[model samples]
Target: MTTDTQTQPSSDPRYPVGRFHKPQTIDAVAIETGLKTLEELPRKLRNAVADLNDAQLATPYREGGWTVRQTVHHVADSHMNAYIRMKLALTEDAPVIRTYEEALWAELSDGKNAPLEWSLQLLEALHSRWVMMLRSLDDKQWQRTFVHPEHGPVSLQTGLLMYDWHSRHHLAHITSLRQAKGW
Candidate 1:
């Protein structure tokens, strides 16, 4: 049986860094690497959109997928939720986290037209606080679990790895689009 951590057979544009291969196991080394990815995400993301203008940002990375702009804002929105979830998981007993309609959220005004700098700056601050919180977690804290209404229980260790993969995934979307369009 294919598990969540297994990489899929094809390289779809929709999943640029490939689907997140949820590791079959979790350890300090794995968490450390995830932490590195989380720490570097802000800088890498800033560089991804550094030279794009409004017209370019509005272009879709794929035929029917979100525009580069929406992706940026979505990252901000999604990560904000994740940060809150982490907080909840730490203080509460297996708290069930809220789910969002990301597609609908992408269609909202700010998500579609907000300045890239806004999301970029938000990511910088978000990741800063996020990384700080993550770095302080002890062994017991790392095993904290949160229930996703849809996906069921998720441990902080797995969440860290998934979000780390998420950062690289979206970065590839922006960078691949730039390469394809010769931007």
Candidate 2:
């Protein structure tokens, strides 16, 4: 029986690299690896969106997801918050970190229509400073903790892992789209 039925892509397009899962323990090796990933993110991300035109950038990686443009800007916005959170954790005793509505942030005009270069450049500079800060942290500093209203009591090590995974996760979203579309 040859009944025609359209088959959609098997995988979840929104999470091409799967979701982030915090590790049970954060060791020196894990910290080293996470730092390496953080260092490489700016370059990896830049390469992902390179040569993409406005129309291509406007195209969503998934059917009902933010456009590539929004994704890039969101990375900048999110990473900025993370950098500040790191600083706060270093200074305070488990400070409560603020959370914003990322979906709403993506709807802002700058997120939707601003040039990707702005975010890319911001990411590069921010990451450079962030990497420097990460490298300068002592063992005690890495043990610093922050409280998220939702997650609660996030250590610096976990924060590092989360952002490292976050970098790869979002990069995969764009790269997978490029491969799927032959871009």
Candidate 3:
């Protein structure tokens, strides 16, 4: 018989799907406030994740899906890419951020087999550097723009807001999955 795990989707998709479908739109003031919230996100996420054990971290909500380790690693990878994009935007005149096949990255061996500790460490370091980058940006730097081939024009402000949204969204997903499984 097919179990619940066989029928369900990964928790990460529950909220972040909206971000993928609806591109971010925000004003500078909103971006500033959102960036503040984003800066606090790593500590909040680490706190939330602290209660979950390695099994919980490794459990896939569904079959043929990523476990929590993969999800955390994906966050690190995604944030690293965003940090690089922000740097490019500040340094270049309307640079286009390079896109990669996210699905392919999600399927790599590390994604499939890495220990939860590695993903957690990556998340910690990635968020540390990303927050530093955000904190260092002046108003002009925050306003820097880049063209994403798929998402059209994106500003560092909007990207920061999106990253803020990203952290909470994934945290919610993780919480929901844990509740569903009573873990």
Candidate 4:
């Protein structure tokens, strides 16, 4: 008879916030909205895990998913790569950005065991700088493209949207886990 997030599992735990939608048309308003998501992630994610002790941090958001600790670290990892990719796209023409094994990265010593403070602090600083640069991009600059070896060419507008969705996506994982476990 009880219907709460804890009692009712989301349709797909992997995508509590739903998947990212590639926009048919991305304008400045859309870019600004995405920037807000980017701007807010550090504070939002930090608060999501603020009170969780190490034991809770080690709990996975879902079956076969990254633990909360790894999730936080992974955000730092992924966002760092994104920041660099954006920089490269702006400086170089259709730069071929390198890819990484995100799953494997999540299993590394830093990702798996390092204090969340380190990554949280890094995100605060990284997002600050990233937002500053993103805000300065002109309409012509937003059209800049970067090529992921696998995903093909990605415009800055699209990157902004994806990372914005990504910001919400991963944050949902942690929050949804907390709700489910009644933590």
Which residue runs of candidate 3 sit more than 4 Å off their true CA positions?
A: 1-13, 16-29, 51-55, 62-65
The C-alpha lDDT values of all candidates are 0.88, 0.86, 0.68, 0.90
Instruction: Report lDDT (Cα) of residue 123, candidate 2.
Output: 92
Candidate 2 residue-wise lDDT, 107-150, digit = tens: 99999999999999999999999989999998888989999999
* Candidate 1 RMSD to the correct structure: 2.6
Query: What is the TM-score of candidate 1?
Result: 0.94
Model 4 TM-score (2 dp): 0.94
The order of the candidates by lDDT, greatest first, is 4, 1, 2, 3
Q: Which residue pairs in candidate 3 collide?
A: none
For residues 40-59, write the lDDT of model 1, one tens digit per residue.
99899999888888899999
> Cα deviation of 178 in candidate 2 (Å)?
0.5
Between candidates 1 and 3, the one scoring higher on lDDT is 1
Candidate 1 weakest lDDT stretch, 10 residues: 1-10
TM-score of each: 0.94, 0.92, 0.77, 0.94
> lDDT tens digits, residues 1-183, model 3?
112111223334554324422233445566565566566666665665677777787786456556776676677678778889988998899898789876689789877677656766767777777777777887788778989999888878768767766766666566666777876
At residue 13, candidate 2 shows an lDDT of 74
In candidate 2, what residue range of length 10 has the lowest lDDT sum? Answer: 1-10
Best by lDDT: 4
